[model samples]
Target: MPIKLADIAIFIITLAIIVFYSVTTLQKDSNSSYAKIEIDGNTFIYPLEKDLIKTFHGPIGDTTIEIKNGKISITESDCKNKICIKMGKIDKLGQAVACLPNKLLITIEGESNDEVDILSY
Candidate 1:
């Protein structure tokens, strides 16, 4: 059997892509951290304090926002565009739940108080 140059190129490209994706995925997973949610000056420590999940909802230019679990996600909305729903679930620290039209912002705070030196700037 003879191997073509094109075949060798394709194999090399595929291997490079696989290696890149694997490294990126591992980095993301390893950096993930647990967080507590804070919305509108109220802290939602339900997941830590009560072992329960709570949901938040509001109008965002006709879209509704919903957050639950240890994560924030959009459950229902009326927006002509469903971009919020596509944003998916967020459970890590510094993650956010935002509804642009409704002026709602939910931020996740990590359990750790240690700060990265570069972040101080």
Candidate 2:
């Protein structure tokens, strides 16, 4: 079958729309100033400006997190798959890494703001 001009125009428009939305949804690293660690319902806040290493104890085992040069990463974990550690560093606002097996969650957040955007049932 031969392609028509209408189909080419539609394809270009769709590709442009996808790129625009994806680029607009990205969070800039400059707005990310700190990291929030939530472990077993306990919350710990740390600044990204400083370099430090901390370990949290979870139901499964210990999980080690590191913050250096304005980025945070899961350096070590006792989780079976170690998927969290493999996720690497994140320095953008709203970026997160989760060790589900260890019940640990780390998210890069901006300055003080207390607003719930979404809730799960």
Candidate 3:
């Protein structure tokens, strides 16, 4: 079998794409951020810098969220699986924990004015 230049180019392109995605996914924002909670269709936004506890009631029951030391986590939930609670804490922008049965989602969001310098990517 003979190696072809076209095959080498395709492999290089694929490797570049994989590296790009991996770098983007592994990077976490260090700037100040916020936490967003979505229940049903309504969304509640909170600053991640604040320390507070919130409980949201849904058709199933209550879901407890706690934000402390710039980290947010689902401390309690009435859902049967308890997967949301197992998601642990999230402090970086774009991290999320969701409860499908209760239609609840908690996501980390950063300020829009945050500069996207070379280091950010």
Candidate 4:
């Protein structure tokens, strides 16, 4: 079958969308960054520039996180599947890794600002 006008239009639209998303995702901020760790009801924030290792307790067991070279990763965990540890490292803003069984979440975030967003409400 021959290509139709609609097919070309759709291809162009899809290519444009892919290009737009790629450009936006590649932009990185220069602001200071941190890793926000949350387990149960407690929250902890640590600077990404600092290298450290910390373990937190959850309902199941302990989850250890490590920060090195401005990136963070789940270095150890008691969760059976260990998918969290396999998640590797994250250093970009808004990247996250979670261990659902341990009720743990680690998110990469930038410096806080005075402006409020929808989540703050």
lDDT, candidate 2, 1-121, per-residue tens: 8999999999999999999888866744344478999999999999899999999999989999999998999999998999999999987767789999999999877753333213211
Better of 3 and 4 by lDDT: 4
lDDT of each: 0.55, 0.85, 0.86, 0.87
Q: Please report the TM-score between candidate 1 and the true structure.
A: 0.43
Which candidate, 2 or 3, has the higher lDDT?
3
Candidate 2 ranges beyond 4 A from true positions? 1-32, 112-121
Give the residue spans of candidate 1 off by over 4 A. Answer: 1-69, 115-121
Residue 120 displacement (Å), model 3: 9.1
Better of 1 and 4 by TM-score: 4
lDDT per residue as tens, model 3, 1-121 = 7989999999999999999999977776456688989997899999888999999997799999999998999999999999999999998666789888889999877764255333345
| Candidate 4's TM-score | 0.67
The TM-score obtained by model 3 is: 0.67
Which window of ten consecutive residues has the lowest lDDT sum in model 1? 45-54
- Per-candidate clash tally: 2, 0, 0, 0
Tell me how far the alpha carbon of residue 106 in candidate 4 is from the true structure, in angstroms, after superposition. 0.5
Give the better candidate number (1 or 3) by TM-score: 3
